[model samples]
Target chain A: MSSLEIKHLFGLRGVSKHDIRLILDHAKQFREILERPVKKVPSLRGMTVVNLFFENSTRTRTSFELAEKRLSADTVNFASSNSSVKKGETLVDTLRNIEAMKIDIVVVRHKGTGVPKFLADNSNAIIVNAGDGAHEHPTQALLDMLTIEEKLGTLEGKNVTIIGDIRHSRVARSNLWGMSTMGAHVTLCGPSTLVPRNTDLMNHVTWEPDIKKAVANADAIIALRLQKERMDDALLPSMREYRNTFGITDELLECAKDKVIIMHPGPINRGVELDSDIADGEHSVILDQVTNGVAVRMAVLFLLAGGRNNENA
Target chain B: MKMRKPSSSEFPIAVLKNAKFWNGKSFELRDEVRLTSGQNGDTIEYDCKGALVLPALFGFGLDFMEPLRDDVYTCADGVDAMLRGGFYGGLYESAANPIDDADKLTAAENRFSSFGCLGSSFDIKFLGAYSKGFGTDSLAEMMELAESDAVAGFGDGNGVIPHSRFLRLAMEYGKMTGKRFFFQPMDKTLRHSGCVHEGAYSDMLGMKGIPRIAETIAAYTVLETARFLQVPVHFKQVTCGETLELVRDARKKGMDVTCDVGLYHLLLDDSCLETLDSAYHILPPIRSAADRDALWQGVVDGTINAISVNHTPVLRQDTVVNFEDSVPGALSLEVALPAIWNKLVAKVGEARAIELLSTAPARLAGSTPVANNVVVFAPDKPHVVVESDFAGHVCNSPLLGAELPSSILAVYINGFWKEL
Candidate 1:
């Protein structure tokens, strides 16, 4: 397929496998372009893309901006802190004003779930969800998938385990949906208090309460950041207790396969979710995930903006 | 049918010919009937062939947002939706504008009363706030308002009353005054900002779950407190079947407790959340299918006493947001009767459904029946639920664009027969 079945990259829940394959294949081509001496592409030379971040983000925003710049698209950054959004302008009104500026694509990150779909419904521009409150981070998941595929050759029949704060991570949700679609087996490991309650989502994956057992058979283990506010919410006891229990340390890796890769959707709570060594070790592909993020995003932007692969260069 | 808006209290005395009604078991036909008025005002006669005549509905625990001065719809739109749905009277919640004092209460009552020119004196009553601005420190200045003409009952209009010492004192005060208090059973901490029922569906959708224990534990506490104090209480928006077991046991022991469920709760469930349609984002979020079925059983076995339309009118802009951010409630009054009829009345015969929708809620609201006030609904008259069909401004509704199997044809209130 030359194009995606879906017009908007809302989430991966209902995304077809064929569309995912197409995006991944194009991402591979983009990754090759990224390594070239002259990396910029003129595909979207005249098109304007707006980055509407209602919530604060570091890497995801920077990665998307870098990808937009690399694709030669005129990028406008709209941050909520200094924008009219803080002046009591509603989301729809702000979007209408942006659309009035003739923007071609809208990449939004909102604290509210399903905001991407909401923007897509209200405006004419193509929507890319950078992250939507605990709902999904589609591009992040796409990059994770691309990283896994690059290292392991294919996602089919691979065992991918995700640990810590499974209940609230948009990264885990998107990864589960996207990775599972590519025929990978997903195992969720976390404190019992943090597992998503009574969900059929558990039916699609195995739940291992023991961190060692969870990572034992994994081809890749993703350690999610443990937010400190969870202690105030009484979702956890303390960071020390969580680290001792479920954190990805070198000691915990002894039970895992030798080739088992380690990943984190970053700004990692180093000692809390992953040890420094585990995050930087030979098996660590954390930085690779960030690099693939730009390429995957380029593929997403190109696909949604209706740019063909080779024609984009 | 397009209705000619009537001035308040200017109802015409008319004779409805060949009207049919549900006599418990089936639809029974009646010959010419004279609907009279206290004042012999404008008299208009009309033939009501093939129409189901029933008492105008009195909704309980109903809510309409405080008028948004800049928005398209206002409090009058809510009144129009209720009247168009065949409701003559309803107990309005003071949620949007908290009623902590006599002034706010009187203002709210007067504001609702002003819409009387559009419909019959829409007997809108207000539930006094449980505490001062819903604070836990002290009870609201409702001791004086309780004796006033405007107070429907004592309860928090917007949220659940925390099980604090303040709640116990409020219960004692309610007991001393011999007034009914409404309890919205819930533990907020346990609810954890969940917007959907805690279950398989919420898990799959990655939305936070509102566990059933949040209602059950709070309900048990409320039930025990009311029983101990010998105070009469009513549970509003009871959504779980587990809570029903407690209510049934309490009633069996004659604890002087009663409960009502949202009209939409019986018809929908958490599975509907899969669509992520913000319209289905209701508070005390639609529970599991098992809970929906249990609610039906509660209705049949008389465990659930009445149905409230909970006719909340959120602005069109507020409802178009994401599922989690979208405000709860749908503009239900315009489509309530048809939805209830197609889902309930048609299958179980009209008497029981009418009792749940009209008679029971009226009794709960302590309304003395109006002799001539009646609704003429046409079950065979199919109509599409559209924005233009609403007497109010365009608003949010789950039933919009829906094809309902029935429609309300006209209403006779204050001796006037208004075709709708």
Candidate 2:
């Protein structure tokens, strides 16, 4: 199989179907490695990876660290709050200093859009976007895609509904591009205030303000977390009203097809965006998404590390 | 006001031979238009082969932040830059610091007159601020300011007054002075700290979206008020399709309303934000492709009267920040003409472009195109826009590094001809 030829996973907006399949195919191998007792690979033994997160994260950082360790690659973790960034160092300066140490790749997460693209343009090392503001979160979309493909077989002709604050969800943006590119009909469902008006411009993507109508015939339902900070901006009336209007309950699942997969990118607001029972229910693949994240990221790290060899080939 | 006869002794007569000249209405090929020499200098003949000589371009609602922000650019700097871009005159809005009192207005008038006497190849007509400090509630010394013959009209620069009643009151007061009020229509609440146009691009780029409704709603308010009050008002730098329709409807109703679009808005769309480049960041924001096409339609249908540079010179450092943090406005004074000729003239035709750039603006400023004020340009010449080519102080133009398809060859103003 052809390997992914990209140096960075900035977003899924421009990633081709073939490259996505290549990433998924490689992820299968990494998933098998995760099941092994030793759970280690020497594919990236001599390589170095750095987790440079300007934003706070728990699961993504730990997941990346574990993935790097599992591949036998040397890893460094730098949180912006404690680093020289607190001493007024810029994003470029911090990355440049890290690059001076012969780093092979920089996994970055920032609150600013296109930060990874900026670094990828300026630095020689591979730049992987963990998450960047409301722009994109490609790896999250890839893991979610991997989970969907695992549960529902081929993505083509499947109906997938993404419900939440799409205007602020980088996850939603990336998945909109990814799922549609994979030939799935994607429906964006949320409050009218939270859903963007021009989603019809994207292929195979439609927006519905009503949650019931959006999930009625979907084969897969991905519920996004409702950020509480949106209250301050007056984007929402209140958490109680939003939960009443858009929160996914088990009753809501009855609207979808039987055996329809339910997913959420984690740290779920137990009773806000989704019901507590449903989050831990049979249909929910929340934990599986986290498990698949490691394998998907491992595939990403492996393919990008092998990019030079693939280019020469 | 008495029109000055074309004095042969006071103004130099230059024979422009074999050129296409736009004479307020349409382009006509002239074999020779003899210009008599003033006592100051000898008349020189120009063989304007294949050159298009048009009435001097006037920048409506132009801002030069002198006196208040003299460190950025002075009046002389603004005049010199306009001359370089083939413009011989502009209606100067009171910007940064409002010229509210008679003394400040007279000072500005004297400064412009002195600049004119220096043979600067360009003159400025000042628009005294309608309200003190350009505030929404308070009125300035409009009648006294109008006494200075140099005051062309009254404007709040690009600021939209927040209160409708206050705006009506200001217009009522301004009506007595017989000066037209110039304002940009925008609702403060809808535009609330937003930087870019509200659309898919703004959502995807994560920039705050300022909906077209912000402008449309405000335009409706202004048009309704102007219709009711029966006071002449000019809307400056109008951007959206609905606003143009509003203007068209107002004119069909025979309301004395005229509107102008910014040169940047006519040429760019919201897609420029995809690059997240701060250079494209501007007030009122470049809108969607549909909005852009509608703006061009507005131009074609005669709904848009004139085009302004809306030129606010920004320092290079101010533009290098994050897209949201970067200041709005562009250094377009020096590049407006060539950029427009390259981007617009072919689609709209040369005569119409000249009307939008010259006649309409001069008429709005309550001035007629004088015989001596003219620009000669080659419409087919191509030149890349670089920072080095600009004579202005700021280099924050979005068209920097672009190859434009026209160049200004010469400009005649007052009693002198400048070969640019």
Candidate 3:
């Protein structure tokens, strides 16, 4: 249960309650980084991080790359090309060849939800999932938690709403767990067909079919991007209709308090789930989420790959 | 069951019978029948008000069909005394399964009366098995949103039920419906990227192994979940006794739960696995004789309630395995009655065998046998055991259709009879 044992964070299933308390305590130490003057720390200095992208991404990938650089760690981004993929080297072989270079940690974004997890299992160094196939985006979620906690000054007793595709958005999936642990009221808003067939699935989340009701009196609303490419035809009626009902327009913004902030895991569609004005406005934390994304990813890389900070190397 | 009087004025004699299963159909209302008890506190008495007369059928067929569909076909027109509004108010009718459509499912699940257990799957990185999370508020909302018309793959068309998410969903459904939902404990379909179980024949034939660990983990996960939630957990058609011992301990801890063994477990063992007889290919991998012995002990000791057919309708080609490579299960329901009657009576007793086969299974399914769908047997009858002779509805038994001692004479479902 020692804070140092947080090195084994992912090894936590069938774990003792006392062990969980230890990980949370360690997390609390990094949790304090949110309040610092220079949020970037060289805890992971001299380490080399490789961002291997098997699928396309901007927000998570760039944020991770920046997070690594900010930590004074060398960052390498190698995306796959159709030519090599078509030439047919198995993904594992492709990764092993890259891994032969002795990178300290691999920040992987793959289309398979467990691809990063699978890599973590096979690799010698730490593996952080920049994005996984619908399974999880742990770092993205922790940072989202950081943003919510900082904006509201406290996560306990806060009402946070996640609007859009709850089913496919790994952001929403991880956020549900993170927010629940921190004791936030998590409300999910999306089309009924899209709101996940298993509501009984999440223990504390309240599903609202109506966006207005979902965001009303909320401390914050997190807008998730629609993966139009990943979805098939008519997953929703249309982008326009999806916006009319579930989207975040200026009218729906009225449902929130004046101090309520808007957040997104970007590269967002300007007119879809959000307005361009909102994305660029004072209340908008879209950009900040991106900025904090780096900080959070830095914290993750440090904890995961840098061995130990505060503790002597 | 005592009648609870809402007030001193009247005691509601709730004859919650499936009357609609007995309209124009004919059934024998037996006035008198023999009474017999098997294994300690379990017994069969002439609960029937009359000799339930029906057709006599002597053969093999694991049937999922309900009894005669043309009966009273009526429900009280009055509003459900419980819920004030809805067409279901006054009277209730009968159907194969209720809460099938989207609209009624909403009302059925979301009401204050329905806290169906909604569940999700839970596991940590590198964890060999997954744990379960149930009864989340989010799941409650999904129940309200997802109109009822959901059956089996009710949630997703793509079968993308995140193992962790599905556990929570099931528990959530249970919480919502105020009903305990049972999950198939053993899922060989989800294994080290392989389907079907591994058997000794696999080793001999150099086949891929589906280790016992997979099934053990599956059971352990369900057991651990029921322990955490302290809710009713049902592990279906358990074939191994080691697992039953766990359930016994869990139940003793005051978890409202139960377990069942499939008919095959009582009849076959890992010896079947040695054939790599594709016919024996099943999920849990029909295990060793020791395992079967243990399973039988579980049944005799009341560690399990009823014997289930696990009546998986599969094609014969599915069972054609090189080693323990055949599909793991066989169609056993139709032959279930005769199989037990042939093998079990000598081990337990005629009465105990029947209880294991009929009365017990009916109760497990919440099927209250009201004079109909009753199996009448002549205990003294003797029959042969030939693998192919055993009629398994889909494909006859791999034992070349074996014939056991007792023959099935009749089955009465409603007020009618159909010769089988």
- Residue B78 CA error for candidate 2 (Å)? 2.6
The TM-score of chain B in candidate 1 is 0.92
**lDDT of candidate 2 at residue A140, scale 0 to 100:** 91
Model 1, stretches more than 4 Å misplaced? A307-313, B1-11, B22-26, B64-75, B97-109, B112-120, B140-152
The recovered share of true contacts, given per candidate in order, is 0.53, 0.31, 0.00
Q: Best lDDT goes to which candidate?
A: 1
Q: List residue ranges in candidate 3 displaced over 4 A.
A: A1-42, A82-86, A229-231, A306-313, B1-420
Candidate 1 lDDT, B108-170, residue by residue in tens: 776665644543366666788777777787777767778775576887774876766777888
* Per-model TM values vs. the true structure: 0.93, 0.89, 0.44
Q: How far off is residue B98 in model 2, in Å?
A: 2.7
Model 2 misses residue A130 by how many Å? 2.8
Between candidates 1 and 2, which one is better according to TM-score? 1
Clashes of 3: 108
Chain A: TM-score in each candidate?
Answer: 0.97, 0.97, 0.85
Interface RMSD of 1: 1.6
